[model samples]
Target chain A: MNKFKTTESFENHISKEKRSAKAKAFFINFLLSFYLFFSLFFSSSYLIYEKNILPSFFYFILLAFSFIFSLLWTSKNSSLGSMAIYKTNKFLKNRKELQSEFNLFSFSGIFISLVLILTILLGSILVDINLYLLFSSQGLSGAKRIFSALFQPNWNIISQVLSSMVDTIFIAFLATFIAIPIAFFFSFFAARNLMKNSLLGNSVYTVIRFISNFTRSVEPLVWAVIFSVWVGVGPFAGMLALAIHSVSSLIKLYSEQIESVGQGPLEAIESTGAHPVLVVWYAVVPQIILPYLSFTIYRWDINIRMATVIGLVGGGGIGTLLVQYQGLAQWNEVGTIVIVIASVVWLMDYLSAKLREAIY
Target chain B: MSKTILEIKNLEKFYENGVHALKSVSFDVKQGEFLAVIGLSGSGKSTMLRCINGLVPSSSGEINFQGQDIISLKSKELRLARKSIGMIFQHFNLISRKSVLVNVLSGSLAKVSLFNGIFAKFSKKETDKAMSNLELVGLKDKAYIRADELSGGQQQRVAIARALMQDPEILLADEPVASLDPATSHSVMDHLAYINKELNKTVVCNLHFLSLVRKYATRVIALKDGKLVFEGSPLDIDEAWFKRIYGEQAREVGIE
Candidate 1:
């Protein structure tokens, strides 16, 4: 009886250690979540206040959901005899097929709860502050306001949208076009298999990599702002910003693609007494052409969306028109513009996918 | 006086990884002699051939081609010299996306100016010469087809055609039929032999198959671990000779 009791105590100690390890993991995850939440809260504080939003209800909902999730997760390995633990064990035993369904149900439940809580908080705050009076005086409330202010049957909004769209397309096109030639030179230096001198090759690679990183680190909107100060507003500033971003992204993609090309062709070219440039042209470029095209098209699609957003800060695109509509409190016009932009993006995505498939 | 078309004197190559790939290797080829370099893999056979064409720069050596010391030539002169020495690879490295015609045309780039080469502005005579070379390899009909579309044997033939378009004085074939089936290998070997004999071009080929070396080469040079093990006519080499060169490893692998 004494030996049996000793064994039982040892088993209890092992279980306690396992529980503590799991708790440590959970604490680390909770700390990460808290950091992310606070960062978002601080960054968007001005927007929240201007919109007459209170985040207290959101906090409550987050806390409740987190508590429930932690309970569910911990209960799976719980030593305590509870119905929840039994159910969790059974669910885990059949995990593969049931996992997606469980995750979908839980995620949607949390999301809906958060949205409801935030809406309720914002509604209460707006009511307390009498915000409806401000909207009424500005002709921003009710059905007639949006259409009257937006449509006014004026060509200004239409012309602005058209010009902005052109500028965005041109920015994407010119940047990609210019970047290809520059990347072509740097990719050879970057590829390890091609160059004989490791020191020289690595130095060239490092320098080019530094330039690419510096270009991509700054957002296009920030680039646009700097360029606007230097060269004045309109499409040229947007073009310059997009071009710099493209050089960095294109160099990285092109170098990686060049590096991965099969060594067989390269060796063959080398053995034939061909020059390095010839080897690259005949061997490397042929293999990477399809992938390069696919990447360029994808970048162009991303640039189109970014171009619109950058225009809000005078980068010159559809974003300019959207901002103007917002200033005039024309929500219906904003909705129409949003739909048009979405359709354009969707069309480009479909076309790009088809083209990529055809090439491959 | 008989001209020494190619000569290597005390050629040495030490890889950056500190491997002595070739140690004081030396050999010579007359204007029209077919030489077979027989060696196992990693036995300095490839490094020896690449050094002849100046493809891999020798650490300390003198490669005299026709009379000039090619080892000391700078980039422009080296490129010009390379145009005269044609090479073929084991895997037939034709650009898969390019047609056979364009692949053959690529060989002529060293002879043409960089601007014209980039723009692909070869004269009509150059095109005709390329076509004739393709005809010599019996791949004239497939000249317009993308190289990837061809069979292994056919692609090797296309590579041969490309090399022939260079109008080279020396031809170096690095295991040209290693990737092909036995039947295809025989045909490719026949084509290389025909090019050597009919065109009177000096041929130096690296080969593993002894039967092929016996059938094609006038003289066979064997290497064992970056050292010259055998240098004699094909008739002089027997199973015992191969055994001596490859050692007990040959017996284990059952190459005899």
Candidate 2:
């Protein structure tokens, strides 16, 4: 109710303080933009970590170019420059060099200069990154040889490769199918918006959330290795591993969708005297069904790629065949397997994308 | 005999944030009367209606509806009581992805068995009822169309049909025509008036526009700062009473 109150005294007081405030805001904007430019130059020049004069000079030149570009951007009408100027002119009228304006500039300068020093000191500790390993001549040649082989993808191993690729697809399908329903069930228990009303409900949400997060944190390959050790090597172990991981991952996605389900429909349905379960069925289900389908198809796409990695860990599929051939110096066979897996993955990606677009 | 269908005694709602949205509010809706609740925004008109429907649990009060104290009822009992009281929102909160027919059919959820509901197996009788309700709102032809594909006014009409499927004896409309244009507001208001007159269902509606209250309401009540400030016929709210209900500086804003 106080928000509706407007008095003459309040307007007078605001006008009195307005000039100093606008000038301070203008000074802060100017100092901050300058600090941003200087920091950009310092960081880029410092990254080379070199003693050579010429390269260091070139790096500085690149940094200077970036600084000029940033200044130009910040001066655009859509940017903060025009806003500061407009406010200062509106409030200050004919005044200049106010005490508050000077204080704002000094305060902003000290803060940003401290940040620059800390960034340099911290970045010096963030090394161990080797540019030579990635950008060297030998590294370039190695990548070229591998990519060149993809063009001549040997058709000789088409039979072995095709069957292996089929196994990979089957593994993904079985895993996603088994996981989607389980994930759907868990999502209701895990949604904070649905379950935060009671102690029992809150605890159930927390426990489900914790379990899914813990499961998802461990990579699928690690799960496959453990599963294969427990239930010998084959697609069965791979399927189990993929299903377990997909459940946790999909549960996280599904619960978020459940949480974001519109509250308005829920309220309207609840007014009809529907039970909580029926409320979810009628109101919540309709809103999330399309998103759930899209997420499941996306999960399947992810799982197909994961199946290849899981197979390399001895949970059987195309990836197992891939490692076996690669180990025997059979580059030609490895090339064919890689080509087939890539094609299947591309086809799955395309179909899922189209379906998702249509559904949404 | 015009007996009371619903009665409230000293209703108060202090939300979790300590905002006293409603103070001690008390009123009664006589059977078959179209009572319009008139109030400024934040004057507890909505909270009063919501409390009667049991949409939000009241902090303290007795809401006697259909001879039972609604505020004290537990989960299943409350749901059973609610089945006979349908509500419509200003935004017409229909499930956008669902078809108009399915949205109406969903109103019968509380009365259906758990198995049938889970499988979404509506009986032929229920389907027929749903279709008839759609016909009531003049959206029978659009029953198969998605709720979102319809215009705002059409969606609210669909919501009316959905609420009607509950076979409710009383209806609560929370700013039912607030989001609509002036012409459409009259059209939607006319439907509520029709339902009240022809179907003989008791209605408790919250309205911002005073012109609407004068047109459709048989009795009027006004809330100011969560307290009942005025109650009488719509015509009885004279210039002095309107100033007392709204405010001294407030000008009456009206739709066609």
Candidate 3:
């Protein structure tokens, strides 16, 4: 009689608990959405429509609870709610001891996210931008026509495309090849560890760093345009631009690598009473050689990408051919050019990756 | 008894943060003596050795060597002085990527010209000497092998041979065997001993183990908190002196 009574009561209790959970889930979701819609409505309508502040003012208490117990009553009874409470208690316990505690305060994060949303809304109005136009009707047929033409790939111009692509690769290789030596030269003077002990060395380091940073800040395509104007539209201009830009980037990497070398070898070399040049020769160069080679190959890889873009600004590569086709509205020819550039870029990437593997 | 090759008088080193790493210490090293400096870690033995080569500058002191003051020497003079005094390190400090022969050849940096060294156009004579130096360390067979591939003891021996490339008047070993096993330590110490005994090079080494000090050191000195506390024959260091040198809580560790 006692067992029958307990089983019957347990089944009744289980159903009651589940019923309350279902009801609570629905009610909480409804309350959360209603409270949330007011802020969302205000933020979204800044430029599109003016909002009525009446709802936010009328449900002020509801808004307060929505923000305050945001993670509490909205979550499951024993899961997220209990976990958050447990973490908050743990943080408080650890705070008294002045030990490392988990970062739990979340008001700033929510505020930042809200501010970003508002900025985007206000910025769209100020800039007269419409991201919705990205899905416009006019460019749809153009994209479809280009893609369909990609399958045919103008076989007659294959040789021309191949030659231009090779020129592009050559421009990349030659530029990186040229830049690496210049960068390597500057790296030693630019390195902090090398220059830390002397006033003259410190000045040279700062100047080299500034030059590298300044040159790197200018985009490669812009450099290409400047060089094109200087050299009169040729592969030479492309190569020169890539070389200058790469030198700046490579200098920073190589110098940092030079600084990271082991101090033990440095001390040992210094104690040998070797000259300053000899110290760099024996101690610095050997340690940095592998990493230098690695960085140069990587820069070459990056320059291949630069080669394609520079040609668009009259720096003479596959991109010159690409722009020519596009100007004539020869979508089919442009498709072939795109296919050729992509495959070559992919090939160059593969080759460099293989080379890097062999080096390591 | 040999003549004194190096002399120190009233040495003082005050670091930037006001830590006195070496107090007003004084000592003289004879030409062919094997002197071991025993002390706790950070007790300024390394600093003292570095001061001898002008690797670390003394704030106030006389580091008189071969009738010349090392402390106040100019850059070129310092480099020239360093050429004759070869130093080996605890970590071996070999360029791990280079071959053993190249590393040994690097020791000839002091003697080579700036242009020749940068291009690594080592002369035939330099090459022969590097090979001979390798042979001395029994690393002749491993000449073309990468330095990091060698065992710790072997690397330290290579370091010893590299130092010999200077044809040094004085060899400084700063905790040379501190990273080696007991057997490896003895082997390394034996080479140092051979260099000291057969080649007749004066050796000043910093050691942690008392047993190694007793076995190898012809004369011993102990420093406590940067102050030189004991200096005499190794046999004279009794229990009371040991206690005072290392501190009251210190227990002696022995490596057979």
For candidate 1, write residues A168-278 as lDDT tens digits.
Answer: 778767876877777667766766566544456667777777877787899988998998888888677777888788777877787888888887777666545566777
lDDT string for model 2 (B67-143, tens) is 89998898689899999999999999998988989889888888888789878889999999999888888889999
Cα misplacement distance, residue B27 of candidate 3 (Å): 3.4
Docking model 2 quality class: acceptable
RMSD of each: 14.8, 10.0, 15.6
Q: What share of the true interface contacts does candidate 2 keep?
A: 0.56
Of models 1 and 2, which has the larger lDDT? 2
| Model 1 clashing residue pairs (backbone) | none
> Which candidate achieves the best DockQ against the true structure?
2
By DockQ, highest first, what's the ranking? 2, 3, 1
- Fraction of the true interface contacts (Cα pairs closer than 8 Å across chains) found in each model: 0.32, 0.56, 0.55
Residue A312, candidate 3: C-alpha displacement in angstroms = 1.6
Report the poorest 10 consecutive residues by lDDT, candidate 3 chain A.
Answer: A90-99
Which regions of candidate 2 are displaced past 4 Å? A1-127, A133-155, A325-333, B97-99, B119-150, B240-249
DockQ, candidate 1, comes to: 0.13
In order, what DockQ does each candidate have?
0.13, 0.31, 0.22
Better of 1 and 3 by DockQ: 3
Question: Which scores greater on TM-score, model 1 or model 2?
Answer: 2
Error of 3 at A265 (Å): 2.6
Whole-model lDDT values for every prediction: 0.73, 0.83, 0.81
Error of 3 at A195 (Å): 2.8
lDDT of 1 by residue, B167-192 (tens): 88999999888788889998898899
DockQ metric, candidate 3: 0.22
